[model samples]
Target: MSGLFSSKRLRWFAAAIVILNGVFPALWILFTSLKTENELTQKPITYWPHEPTIGNFISAFQDQPLLTFLTNSLIVAGLSTLLSLFISALAAYAIARLRLRFRGLILTAIIGVSMFPLVTLMVPLFEIMRSLGLLNSYWALVLPYTVLNLPICTLMMVSFFQDIPRDIENAAMLDGCTRISALWRIVLPLAAPGVATAAILAFVNSWDEFLLALSMNSAVAYRTLPVGIQLYQGEFAFPWPIISAALVVAIVPIVVLIVIFQEKVVSGLTSGGLKG
Candidate 1:
């Protein structure tokens, strides 16, 4: 009994440490955003703001076209997530349900492709976008984001698809449902947790992507939030408070997404673990 109690306490301590590690930075940013610039520069640092104000949040927008950046990010992330899920679903279903030649090799190739560092792809992607006349445009970001998200999304869904019984799909086929139709009406619904998980992951990746967005969409009007946020820092000086406020703003959508889809994400992860 004492040993079990000690083990439980240790697990709780580790979980608390992990949670604090992730939560502390965001909490610090929020606190900093609420502080005045004068307080930020004071001799003695303060953990909590002595004089909190909404000025930084207001200034974050006024200092840059933050709204436009927010809009661009939303459009890019949304489109990319939809495309990633659509394509990944088709590919995953084919890999999981269809007995195609070299399916295992194909999956391995996908995993290999996804493992390549984003920096290495930058030059080639930029040149491709330029040649296609896609640079400084939403498609420039969306297309690459979709491609970057595909491998993981497909692999995740494949695990979920494999977990589902073939009898369910075979019965649907007896009911005059084609494979594609069954995938739409049956397999997909059954794998809703995986779908939700993949969608959230894809959206978050696209939302947070910096290198491709910065390189491909250099135009101010086309810039995403991560790239646009840099405009807050001048060569001469950094506006820490206003930048924190913008960072806080940038964080809200992702936080909301995770909170909303958190259950599905956990379910998908747990199912994947068991499937493995």
Candidate 2:
């Protein structure tokens, strides 16, 4: 009985540590956002705000075109995620169901493509976008973001699609549904968790990407939230509170997305692991 009790206590302790590790940094940033600039610079550093104010948030908006940045990010990230999912879904389904030769090699190549350092591709991508007249446009970010997200998204979907029994899709096809139609109406519905998981991941990656957004969409009109946040820092000054506020605001969409799809994300992650 004592051994069992000790084991349970250890497990609880580990879980608490894991939760705190993840949650504490965000909480610290939230706390920092509410503090006054003077309070932030004071000695011994306060854990919470001495005087909470929304001034930092207001300044964040006024000092830069924050809303415009957010809009650009939304458009870029949304388009990227949609394109990634669409292309990945078709590719994954084919790989999962079709008896295509060298499918394993194909998946390996996909993974290999993703493994290339983003930095190495930047120069080539820049030239390509410039030549195509895509620079400073949504496509500049959207197309690259989609390519970056495709490999992992496709791999994840393949696992989920493979796990689903073929009989279900076979039945649909016999009832006059084409393979594409059956995928749309049948297999996809059953793989909702995987779809949700891939979407959130692709969205988060595109949302937080800074280098591509900074380089490809240098125009003020097309800058994303990550690039726009850098505008807050001057040569001699860093408004930590205002910057923290922007950080908090930047994360709201991602937080909300995860919350809404938490169940599917959890199920998808766990079930994907269970696949052979």
Candidate 3:
């Protein structure tokens, strides 16, 4: 009883520390966005603003098309995530259930594609995009993000699928359900956590991706939030207040996602823990 109590206390303390560490940086940026420029540039930076203002927030949109960036981000990330999740679910289902030769090798190969350095592929990806007229379009970012994120999403769904007993699938088949139907009806329903996990991760990666987004879209109209943040910089100095305000705006979608899908992520990660 004493040992269990101590273990629970330690876990709670560790969780608190982790939560604080994650939230602290965001809080600092939020605070800085409210501070006057002079206070931010002070010898000893102020922890709390003496007079908080919404000017930075106002300037973020006024100075540039921040809303356009946000919209582009949403379109690219949303489409890429949806496509990646759908394809990953199909691929993961096959890998988990199909009696294909070299199954392990195929999985490893997919993961290997992910491990290929992003930089090395950039030049080829750029040329391909230009050849296909994908440059300066959302498809440029969306396609690359979906491809890059597939392996991780596949692995995630695979783990969740593996946790489900084979008997459930067989039972569904015995009930006259086709293999595809069994997957769609039985397996997928049981793997909601994995689906949510893959979707969230794919969305976040596409939303935050910088290199592809930067190189793919030369037009301001197609620029994403991460690259759009750079538009505030100049030869003279960085606009710290405006950048901080942009970051605060940028944080909202991510925060909302985590809040909505936090449980699914946690469950997907721990999906197979009880199984073997």
Expressed as tens digits, the lDDT of each residue in 165-211 for candidate 3 is 99999999999999989888999889998888888889999999899
lDDT for each of the candidates? 0.95, 0.95, 0.91
Clash totals in order:
0, 0, 0
lDDT of 2: 0.95
Worst 10 residues of 3 by lDDT: 267-276
On TM-score, the candidate that comes out on top is 1
Order the candidates by TM-score, highest first — what do you get?
1, 2, 3
In the predicted model 2, the residue pairs found to clash are: none
Indicate the TM-score of model 1: 0.97
TM-score for each candidate, following the candidate numbering:
0.97, 0.96, 0.91
Candidate scoring better on TM-score of 1 and 2: 1
lDDT of 1 by residue, 1-276 (tens): 999999999999999999999999999999999999889999889989988999999999998999999999999999999999999999999999998999989999999999999999999989998999999999999999999999999999999999899999999999999999999999999999999999998999999999999899879999999999999999999999999999999999999998998999899888888888
Clashing pairs in 3: none
What residue runs in model 3 are displaced by over 4 Å at the alpha carbon? 1-17, 174-176, 272-276
